[model samples]
Target: MTHHAYADRRSGSRTHADGRPPAPPPLPVAARRGPAGRRLLTGLFLVGLVASVLPWWLDTPAGSLTDATATTTAAGQITGLLAGYLLLVQVLMMSRLPVLERVVGGERIAAWHRDLGVTLLVAVLAHTAFILVGYGGLTGRSPWDQAGVMLREYQDLVSAFAAAGLLVLVGLTSVRAVRRALPYELWHATHLAGYAVLLLGFAHQFSNGTQLFRPGPVRTGWIVCYGLVVAALVWGRLVGPLTVNLRHRLRVADVVAESPDTVSIYLTGVRLDRLALLGGQFFRWRFLTRGCWWQSHPFSVSAAANGRWLRLTVKVVGAYTGDLRDLEPGVRVWAVGPSGTFTAAHRVRDRALLIAGGSGITPLRAMLEELPPGAALIYRARTPADVLLHRELDWLAQARGVRIWYVVGSRNDPGPRQVMSPDGLRRLVPDVARRDVYLCGPPGLVEQSRRLLRRIGVPRRQIHVGTFEL
Candidate 1:
């Protein structure tokens, strides 16, 4: 459908029954209420910031839920909801990243995304309150009696434990100060703990939840959903990597370092195409015979899908990718994907706003060739040197109806940050509010562009960004 028709169909969609516009229906819980949400707590935080400034919710006093037992019950429900929802959100975010890039417009889904995140957060907090109330019956002397009561009856002990574990895992990651101070490798390992917490939560629900444990279809349905989520995470996060390692893979191809620490690797192995990848997808390639599986990292494909050879342009970021420039042409490398589905195909908007920062420019370079006409690009790089695909981008810009903006930040002795935040894109583009904006790159750039767009009155329905570059 045309943009106008599509928007009309999706809007409150008031039907004229004998010439009167009907009131909008209540928001559906199953559907995503917004186009998309921020990743994990990050999206929650951005929305939270937005929420704090507005009187969106009803008036509730500081101790509105002051009743001790009531408060505990409310907290328990909220916590339960949060843990389950976050797990689902993280999995969805990671899995959708690759394909989401292919689509042109994400803002259309913005409402659903925002609503899901908010609802889930509230559920978790409520879940926590409920659990607290349940446990309040236990004094120091009555701990065993509470335990006996829990054990004697088919209560949700397992789920409660799972809820506690999920909370702990989410809580630890929630602390930005702690997460940032830890090395990437360390943080990554610790984050995997969520998988275990989720598994326990699933078991707890089956054992405790009144709805989930019922006989026949009701129980089976929840079991299936819980199983699918855990299975997807295992396949995407851990098992996929292990399977690649077990296959005894070969590197097969290597790149001629275009610059220091940056080189392209042409990978060839058994059934590479069968790896099920799209043009802008990525992989966590592990080249071993040495270190650990914990070191494998994600890299985006700099080239489009050709079906014959899988290609990647990687710059040495730290430990794993740092040594990538020197990889032997014939060395053995375990490739764990054709993963992530971010491309421009998912867009309904013909005209687009494409933004990129630092290494983030690589994936966009691949997407640019595939982008339909009338697409605008704003690329941020430090000086002319750090601009990775200048030649390719410029060539695409030469295509009719394409606009390109290169923001160079540093003036003298340069660094990546010299061009990091391309605030200049805001001033240069006067009509930005009309287009759907897709951003990839540093967090600062993505965050800034979004804020700038909002300040200029672009509907929240038109701005989009992924949680991470990959």
Candidate 2:
């Protein structure tokens, strides 16, 4: 339907006849609690940092750093320790545990994973550089010759070198520019090489490192840290999905084209209610189809789950999504999520203002159906043709007393019609600042809207942002 048609349909919605929405719904009790997990995670990071350096400090003799060789060795040990700790942390951040995702949000976790990965690469490089220099200085040999000697003499030095090279490759591909240049499948596959790097690096550390080789509290602590990290990875990433897929046996029930480039896939499985997904949450779904089984793409639930049914609307953005339009019924599926914190559980106010861009409406559409009345949705699209699920929005407007505003105009229009700007936002939703805002979209739009929301007097704590970026 055209934007004008949708406008006319919603003209008589009359959710409230006073030219104002009703009083906002009261915020849920769970929403008022502060982010306890964030604080706890930060504390753990600090503790880990201290633990990482404590061994080197305790073992070093007084005035050890007075000698250049000792100083270089000490610095190398510090970098190695930090790199090892951070490598484990990178795994933990992406363990995909529901409790962690609920507490810290998936976006924050993914971002932390990327940041820590970059830092880990730098530390590993520094560790190599320092170790080469220190050993070369002590042995009166050139750095290049010392490197060959160490690799030939050390137990796991070859594996360590291989791990470092793999780490560098993964890190380079993860760069924003490099990632965008590659296909999602290629990038994702490249990213998974981190697990291999971790394995090789771990062997190198235990076999050659003096700190970990010593039987003491430091070694015990390293063992415990690695053990927990391995357990988390196994359960959260591997066994968790395997168990869920076996129990649920999710399969495609139907597929309906929602727009020229968008298709809504209906999934059904045994005991789907057990999944317990929130309204605006998403899953990394892998469809067991010939052309689509290799990679799982994250898509928000387009509608609330009803016992055995779940729906996700996907836009044709890349090869994976483009192939989804042709997906048939009865395809087996495996999912690894319900991850994110954009649901009503995170709301901080009674009134909610949901801002969506393009296909970002999927999750918000689900939220509109499940959220209490006194919520308003502002959907921004580049043109009338880009607006999706208008009929459903209007139906909700009439049935559930929720206001729906479809801002259909060219985003690139240089004039006054860019509804995403601060001025346009204020004009569209005069009471926006009073409502808790939930935003989901591309990175650029989400960041820009966040800034606009902040500038318009919306407190940072009251605005929740979700992104589609991996």
Candidate 3:
């Protein structure tokens, strides 16, 4: 391979659909939910209660239902609260991310964020199930048996069907493998339907809920909270986009062939502080005229807080990354994010594990520079030639308390030492379970290390694996 191509030691990649490789995968999930999750949950529960109870308190007669007695009314109210609880939890986990990002570093925050996402998905699914059952019981029809009244042109029934469709879409993306199968560009567009889903959920709660007749102090409180959260989401989606388009601007400064397939770009952007970015968070960087901005490529800041300079390490893999090695510096770029919550500084327990595969080492390098003490680093690359900045890494390890374990995949003429597999990890560190493990590598290697750690008794929480595609 040419030195330029060989210089960029990105990950192994297959030829993309368009006959070029894309950007290699990025660091895994971010750490979300510290004090933020709890607060949002509390706020949402209140709002849901009020949304449900207001109609009842307002002295409005119960709508066209035969069983409008206090028991049924109470049941509906309980259903709304439970359903609202789920919504609140989901929003809490996704929103107010600034606070959560502070608690944990950016990369693993994203992974945990996705994991918690599954939690929210389950909540929505269960809430939907409960609503269907409750409404069906009232109508004397099975929840799944929607043939009769749904055809009657009732506004409420029509709303129910719409809500059902949206729920189905959300549920479809909940599965892990299915999610990976979908094109990310399409997935994001589909994900935005969440706003519509929220709207439908609120409308359903408002028009059909028995609690709206409630003339209570608590009902008023719920109304205020629900309105606030919805308003915030609208601002986030709408205003957030406008701001990205205008305020936080990025311009590509340089593209260097660090390894054959792997390249690095330096970004000079305005409003770094305004971005409210934590170190390990990533962005959906689109070179606009070149790469897929609409598609949103997620790349972590290899080294951020450069005041105005942000570095992104890339490895060619597909449509987005194919031409990265050829790009010149100083090109204007538009990117969105600072998303995901994966990083250190949150784990009060000092000891840690930092695993890096090729360019995935970028974010962890920044993390180590920021807080180098009390951590063990496992840097793995295909061959010894692939290890970039080895001397610098070694110097840092000696200065700071970072223990280094370099696993060169190809080590011929070995002196009775091996560094390629999980067995190498076991030999290098006997106490893997006791420390907080931080891994940043290809999915395959990360998964292998994770399984080994688990088998050896590392708790899931302690094994901070970076798996977010960004």
Structural similarity to truth (TM-score) of each candidate: 0.63, 0.90, 0.72
- Candidate 3 on 170-254: residue-level lDDT in tens? 6677567877899776776776665566666665555555564354655566567677676665554456655775886778766
Better of 1 and 2 by TM-score: 2
**Residue 64 local lDDT, model 3:** 34
Top lDDT prediction, candidate number? 2
Alpha-carbon deviation at 308 in model 3, angstroms: 4.4
Off by over 4 Å in 2: 1-33, 412-418
What is the per-residue lDDT of model 1 for residues 333-396, given as tens digits with 9 covering 90 to 100? 7766555435554343555688787777766666665666677887876656667756545555
Clashes of each: 57, 0, 54
- Report residue 381 deviation for candidate 3 (angstroms): 2.0
Number of residue pairs clashing in candidate 1, backbone atoms closer than 3 angstroms, sequence gap of 3 or more or interchain = 57
List lDDT for all candidates, in order. 0.54, 0.80, 0.60
Which scores higher on TM-score, 2 or 3?
A: 2
User: Which portions of model 1 show Cα errors greater than 4 Å?
Assistant: 1-166, 201-217, 230-252, 269-279, 336-342, 398-405, 411-434, 455-459, 466-470
Query: How high is the lDDT of residue 171 in model 1?
Result: 53
The window of 10 residues in a row where model 2 has the poorest summed lDDT is 1-10
